[model samples]
Target: MKNTIVVAGATGNLGHSICTELIKAGTHVKAIVRDSSDPLKVDALKKIGVEIIEVTQFKEKELTPICQGASCVVSAVTGLHDVIVNAQLELLHAAIAAGVPRFIPSDFSSEFTNIPEGENRNFDLRKEFGQHLEKSSIKATTIFNGCFADILRYNTPLFNVKGQTVAYYDDKAYWKIDFTTMDDTAAFTAKAALDATTPRYLRIASFRVSPNDLVALSEQYKDKRFKLVDMGSMEGFSAYNKIQRAQDSAGEDELYPKWQQAQYLYSMFLVHHEALDNDRYLDLMWSKVEDNI
Candidate 1:
């Protein structure tokens, strides 16, 4: 375990990808999972040479031993309050207790650090956990990789390739939104995990495209003219998003509700990672927007 990396949420899409990348680099990885995790996924990780550790609870005493001597512990788990804030807190303390020097929290999204609090619920939870992570004696690194590029295929209004349209608001037709493919994020993360001197925060994006750029890319890839639709002003859009959040109290019970998606979209417009750390990992094969389209 001294030279090995431990990954929480190893069964997740990003987590699995990270493990594969680390294995490719000849890094020993320990995949942490709950006793209730799917066996098939655990088998998949084992097949790839990842050492699996099953735990009943994410408590410090429980996980500290599993984390002992790990060069880094990566948290790829995603969820609401209980998981994001509470679960990660337990894992963080455990990693520290185990003497892990570096920690990579599951803060993989828009660079909400620049954005004020209360804009996004999931981000709010991340910020809450970040405050705790800050006080810990361990060094931490957070990757803010805008939105995942795979969402483009989901036919959202922002980058609807199937509908051949890219929508914008507040005359932000040219505002670039950051996006990183899950594979690319995983690749960089794997590299970072192996390197113990990584800084506190690293920003990455596979491709940053504005609405107009997306339209052009979509048209070229799909062989169809993509339309650019200006939805409204930023002020109006902000008001509308706030209204949706207020009206949809039921969304609080649901993970990734419509309003939460709206908040992500709004954050996309609001924040941009101007200085990216892509150069930090030169061996990485970054993905382009067209590659995903």
Candidate 2:
């Protein structure tokens, strides 16, 4: 019998990509999604042979049997309070009850273990989920792939292509940041889900680069000089922290707070660099900054 894998948030960017990769690897995929998800996205997954199970809510009693017979459960749900804290936790319990051996939570960012709490809101939510998972009986695997390379490629504020500018939290160019394209992250995640030997925590980077390196790559690819903006380390972090505080007060329903948190997260990556696990998966093909540019 073939290996069966159940995926949550299957219509999402990273989740959809993971489903595609799993299908390519010949694994049986069961995509658990909300009934109100985009019909077009659902059709796309169905066209590719994915088994879709629509649920109104993520209750453990309803989810456990959906997870039955699956070897692993991969969640790519993106959110802070309700989805990550409540929904994903419910999914973990259901997976455990159904006897799934591995549970991969939606941790596709930098190593939050080293970053102090409250520095980044998104990382903080993931950190909380990590703590919850640690206390559970099911084995877990986390994939840390730094920032999304493809998002930065088109997002000019982060990696300004038209303006030829790169923003940094500090004046000096001493920090090294890791980046992985969504496609690469998804492919690696699919492989990790199927591999029973995968460790509890895994890290991978398509390219590890500094601010100067980013400017060089932009100049080389665009054939022009790129300007660097020093936003000041302490000042940037303080501003982002203020935004986080506002978010905490405003509750999770507001979009602007989450958007502000995203800005802070990109800025935090410049000042805080953590250990990477890029070399662990030798068979995976990583993307390069120049290639993305």
Candidate 3:
């Protein structure tokens, strides 16, 4: 049998893209899914010649044999806490037990290690998972590809393209934020998984854009002016941090706290702008912001 690559969370947006790219490259892909997954997605995977396996949980004993003959395992699970911490951890142990050489965790966001704790719960969970991976024997590679470009295009509360408006906490419009389309990120991930010599950490940016860049692109694409609103200064971010800390202590389940944490994250994007690693992968083709716009 050919060496197969197992993909956990294969039904997800990122995982599905990665599986498609791998198949395009003529690699055998085993898509690990749950029984509760959508039937349409499972049928689609089957139609594309992907072997689908259903696992109720990421238990090492059950997954080790399932992962037999697999060369690599790529996880694309997305969520706040449990999915990152519990599910991925179990998957890591399973990979190790199956003697898989390479494992890529679901870390397709901003550089979580660069951000401080208590500011972003999602980043914090990823950071904690990275620490766990470091202590384990599993050889892992983490991909930080900045914000999802699709989010900028469609997630209205985050980027509001249709309204032609952007809300930022900072007063300036000169902070460079990284954005990568899901397809591009998935392609890079698939290539990285196939290459045994790939580095442990990769930072990829499809394109870097600021509020000014967004406004310029919107103007050019829609032939209309965009309105920019500054929510407040860094002081507002500080207040949000304080509130988020309080919410953590109280163990409250309020959406406002998450929104507050998001403000702090926006501030991090402004303060800690990292250089891109897109040029490192010379063969990979990246999407342009103009096309996405």
Candidate 4:
């Protein structure tokens, strides 16, 4: 439709992909960046003819004008949730002021609004923020697309061959949860933002996979079986303690980035070992991954 779209945090993994998707959809895309000095990613966006908006600091006064006449804003800014929340609040205020039609907050982790523990202090910040958007008369869509499958390679030592074996909730036990590829998540989010009927909470699963299934997939790729490492409740807490100690020794400045710490302390915020039975929502699962492994 050639609607003007602004993608905040366009340099991040999800942001980059979302911006790319918007461009591919023939939307006039604006890549908003926090750092002008990082030209590599900026250059990539420029190659695709995406307009660039670099801000040394986030200011509502500055962005409000930029968002004027825009159709939608897809926020893929990952990292600390608090900083993201604050920045998104600024974005929402600006979008409302600018009369932007729709605002999609970066709710990529899970359907936090549906989870019992998600409504509380530990995990409901983003959920509540979505509510705030509705109260303000903005059409906002929240997508819950489970964990980034790629994060498993980076976050868990279990998948890193050079590190300790992949650990799970209990040794050799599997937890069923939804997983979506980064590209799929980006594409689906863009689709949701543009779809007029898109609900406030958009739940999706490109694939319903479990830790056990992933282990099998990895073994298939490597042609070897790795031993399963177990991290029980106590062990999980021990790992958390170790992470906390590391963060403490490094100093408050280096401590858990708000999002990572939030994920650690309140993992219930994510797509856990529960199955999603929402049939009203389309599954939109990509067939490539199904045949890949």
Candidate 5:
């Protein structure tokens, strides 16, 4: 297949999932890993029929040859400016230099493009990279899969497993919040990587679950009556997040600080993944809110 897909950051959770799905689909995946990457992880990839290339630096010249003959490059690297904007930019350049026709950045998050900039720090880094991608010669596809469905089990303020509460703010009780599983996102991205007709943006969610529905589903699954915890207005939550950011300035060096997590919560309620392209790949089965609970 001539390295149909080259995946950077292929050892991470979402990255590994993407590679697994691609290999399952019988596509050749060239996984880019760091020289310091764990041997166990590298061995796992090799066992799965992936070509793992370990590199010391993420330079364009060094990666171009690794990306050569690949139809597309999908980056699953996650982090702040240094990793998100810097590493992905190098990958983008390498893809272009390698004559790869398509690329997908590590934008697997909520509908940040629709949301205003600076609202979320992580999304801000992605927005920064979007500028570079806009002028690139290679074709780009940004997949917004909302929040990972795995968070549903984490018992966040949204779905508190310990408290048995489905939390919400303002009139968002009925608002459908998007949640896509990692495997589901991977399956779709794998399909997209091979499809030449994929557009520049794709929004997908395994479950556009509502607060009320979540509560009901939890109760049905756990056999316990779950409470609806109304946290107050969305504007009030935003204000609280601002206060948190101001108080947690020490977390500026941290990747996901307390305030940053609050920002993610705000984003969950702010925008939605609309015009979903989930139906584009019919063979993939999406995880449901019930299954997650």
Candidate 6:
């Protein structure tokens, strides 16, 4: 029987690619978006033959019907940690109620297990969500894709290769982190969802290359000399903890509620030198994109 997969936040880059990969693989895709009233996103999805469902909110009761006959569920929803936790919980309940067998949560970040629960607020919420999943009958897997490599194209400080400034690492010359493209992440996720056996956590990355190497690549490709400047690690573990402590003191209703929490989630690769690759299953899925680059 062909799998019927319902994707929450299907209009997103990751979610859309996942749907496309599944559709190409002969799976039925039901794309769930917030507002079907938005013609552009909905029209684009409809053009691809994806069945669309409009959801005003993400409550468990509301979403139950959205995922009614799905064999699996994938969420790419991004927002505050609390909002994510609540929506995931609601989805879990809805999935279980709808008899959906598998769920892939919105966890395309770092290794949450390496970071302590209380130490980083955002991860603590994820840990709680994981615990909830464990207690449920439905199978769940979380993908940690390190950092999105294509995000570097934006020239942001986080993945800086802009002009003469690389931000966040103490030694720009020595910093090494794992990165995976969104296309790779989507492909792996689609393959994983199709398989009957799935693990709890999957870390997907094409390679772990240093910023210096990246700058060298840019210089080589662009044919221009580029200087690498260390931004002094202002977004590392210590700074993350400081911000967490400040948020705690100020109360949860502050303007930037979970910005530091999100920071802690992003900084795990920097602090902990653990990069994992599970080849037993991921290798087969990776073959499709192995020759793309």
TM-score of each: 0.97, 0.91, 0.89, 0.78, 0.97, 0.80
**Candidate 5 global CA lDDT score:** 0.89
Clashing pairs in 6: none
Arrange candidates by lDDT, highest first: which order?
1, 5, 2, 3, 6, 4
Give the per-residue lDDT digits (tens) of candidate 2, residues 166-269: 86765556468778899999999999999898888888888877778878877788888688778567556666666667757764565337544454455446
Write the residue-wise lDDT of candidate 6 on 1-293 in tens digits.
Answer: 87789888778778888888888888988887776446787787777878888888778888888787787899876655555678888888999999898999888876767775455555666777778888999988888887666655655554444464444456546566666778878888888888768778777676666656656665665566456656555346456656667757654444245555446434633443364654745354442212211
In model 3, pairs of residues that clash are none
Q: Rate the local accuracy (lDDT) of all candidates.
A: 0.90, 0.82, 0.78, 0.66, 0.89, 0.70
Greater lDDT among 2 and 6 belongs to 2
Q: How close is candidate 6 to the true structure, as a TM-score?
A: 0.80
Regarding TM-score, does 5 or 6 come out ahead?
5
Give Cα distance to truth, residue 89, candidate 5, Å. Answer: 0.8
Q: How close is candidate 1 to the true structure, as a TM-score?
A: 0.97
Off by over 4 Å in 4: 35-37, 114-128, 155-160, 170-172, 234-270, 273-293
In candidate 3, position 266 carries an lDDT of 63
Locate the minimum summed-lDDT window of 10 residues in model 6. 284-293
After superposition, the stretches of candidate 2 with alpha carbons farther than 4 Å from their true spots are 154-157, 243-252, 255-263, 266-275
Cα RMSD to native, each candidate?
1.3, 2.4, 2.8, 4.3, 1.2, 4.3
What is candidate 1's lDDT per residue for 1-30, written digit by digit as tens? 336999999999999999999999898899
81 in model 5: Cα distance from truth in Å?
0.4
- Give the winner by lDDT: 1
Task: Write one digit per residue (lDDT tens) for candidate 4, span 50-123.
Answer: 89988877778888888887888888775444555677888889899999888888777765665554222323
lDDT of 3: 0.78
Clashes of 2: 0
Instruction: Judging by lDDT, tell me the better candidate of 2 and 5.
Output: 5
